[model samples]
Target: MTLSPSETARYRRHLTLPELGPAGQERLKCARVLVVGSGGLGSPASLYLAAAGIGTLGIVDGDRVEPSNLHRQVLFETVDIGRLKAEAARERLLAINPEITVVAHAFTLRASNARELIERYDIVLDGTDRLSTRYLVNDACVLLRKPLITAAIHRFEGQAMSYVPGRGPCYRCLFPQAVEAVGESCADAGVLGVLPGVLGLIQATEAIKLATGIGEPLIGRLLTYDALSLRFAELPVSRRRECPVCAEHPRITALEDTAEACAADAPLSVRRLSATALRRLLVEARRSGPGLVLIDVREPWEFDAGHLEGARNIPLGELRGRLDDLAGEGPPIFVCRSGRRSLTACAIALQAGMAAPAHLEGGLLEWVAAIDPRLRLVAG
Candidate 1:
């Protein structure tokens, strides 16, 4: 894999690095990597991989770019709204480095085509948000014996792990069973805009190391990152002997769609108050002398970041025990970063004998999206 004269000049910085000289640069030029998502994490991971001269790169996503995605999904621009993520990301990557091959897989990954799609690449980077799709990618990568760099983000936190076939445990080895859709995901639990960029770059670094055979990859350990605290910790992970996915006598022989692959949380049944409607109510109540009580279920730190005025900071962890304190507080409208915790809060309210429970429809994220971010935001 000889580098072209132009490529040599383009990767001068990489060539100068002792760890990744011309030989490593050539390996990168010949490596083929597949990034399974084009959102937050995948955006930075794929962008750097492309810029670093990965020979062939694939972007797989069926979602279209929306204004909401622009904050974290840096691959797409304002004009790219409504365009397929993979398509938009492919264009961006090519524009970054036309010297490499960029392939856009503008469809969701499913059981039927997971294996075939993964087989074409030397390494797999799974940054998908769905549990089902994450498991599917993990299983397919294990079956194909391709090294995988997988990472995920939650509100202000993220974790990454690598699986090199016989060297370390697969994603299943860490969590053998997929959970039925329970609780809110990051989509429902809002995340800081910059969190994924940190973990995504870790994925890119791991992929580069795996591609060029330098530096120890994040195998046999789960690397965790806390954005708020600016800290990183590692947890040791070992393969399970009775594990179904990657064990001595594995039960997961084929990539059949299991509960793990079909996992999603059950839909919630609760009264949702739209941000617009809530805003109107707040305005009316302000003029009429505090008619509505807003209960914020986010953590203290999140509440401190920004919250609706007149909201009470009752973190979800303390909501259940403090149910009796709201005896004379009137009907409360719960809120959180995303609507999930608020829904949970509503359920708790119902069980505590409240006839009805209501929450901000999209949480604070939705409010910010619909209204002014800086307006009416104050610490509880």
Candidate 2:
């Protein structure tokens, strides 16, 4: 394909590069990339890919732009808050390069639509934060045999890798199963605003390399970046012989909804108690019952900074090991900075034979927001 006069002027710098000359530039223009999730990583990755002249870009996201997303998600403006992320991202990408086609999928990426959406794109970028979405994207890309560039950012650290199904390891090869205790999200744990920008750009760079066949992609290797220490490490990874998705006798022949995978490790017997209901339960227990034991499952540092008064500290990591401590305590009410860890804790308690253990609905955040605004809230 030949570049138009306007296209030549626009991509003059890229065309000037010997490694990515006219031929490579044309290849990029013919590439169709789908970026799932218009959050932190997707923001920069999609922006750079569009500016680099990817012919067609597909954006998938079901969420709306919140004020909190503005710190790192550069695709939306202050005026765009409350707009659907996919729509906002499409507008921003078009604003960056009107020559490129931007397709907006203003809905969640689920098992039912993942394969169909992925089949239309030459490459897929996994920028989602949820574990379920990550696994879903990976499985879909693997099944469809499409190149996937995936990256994640947590606080000041980030990691990224590229997966090309027969070329090297898939995501499941690296993480055979979902982690039992999922880590806190950017909202709960707090992330440096520029961290995802750094990681997303790397993912974009890898995607471009894959499209243009210019540089060696990150297949069979994981690149980790630590912003606090300013270190970059490339760890070698290998394909697992027993990988369920890519193995000789693949177990997961069809796609499944993995949205609940994060909570799969938790026991099914535990029940959820809203913040208000928990307060009432605590009051009634204090008057008539044996009394309620409110356990804060956050780390000691988080509890020290600020926590619900009268709650005992027991980190989630230590909960399974220290089941003896709560042996004779009243019906346990697990809490955390967010509700996730506490829910995991409640599951642990139930699995360990504790009867009728419950977790605060939205953890301490909801408790403070609904029951006691006077309490200081700390991010996990």
- Per-residue lDDT tens digits for candidate 2, residues 1-380, read 78899999999999999999999999999999999999999999999999999998999999999999999999989999999999989989999999999999999999999988999999999898776788888888988899999887777777788999789988777665555443333356678999999989998998899899998999987786779878775545678788879888888888887635332222323556778888888788778956678888898988988877578999988998988988887778888876767756765675576776788866778878899887776667
Prediction RMSDs, each to the true structure: 11.9, 12.6
lDDT of 2 at 173: 74
Measured with C-alpha atoms, the lDDT of residue 98 in candidate 2 is: 97
- TM-score per candidate: 0.69, 0.69
Off by over 4 Å in 1: 258-380
Q: Compared with the true structure, what per-residue lDDT tens digits does model 1 show for residues 1-380? A: 79889999999999999999999999998999999989999999999999999999999999999999999999989999999999999999999999999999999898888999999999999888777788888989988999999988777778899999999888877666555534554466777989889989999999999999999999988786778668775556678677777888888878866554212222122355778878988999989965787899988887887778888899987998998888877678998876656766776676566645678865787798887677444432
TM-score of model number 2: 0.69
> Candidate 2, which ten residues in sequence have the lowest lDDT sum?
261-270
Residue 315 alpha-carbon offset, candidate 2, angstroms: 28
Backbone clash pairs for candidate 1 read 181-264, 181-265
lDDT of candidate model 1 versus the reference: 0.83
Write down the lDDT of every candidate, Cα atoms only.
Answer: 0.83, 0.82
Quantify how close model 2 is to the true structure by its C-alpha RMSD in Å.
Answer: 12.6
Q: What is the lDDT of candidate 2?
A: 0.82
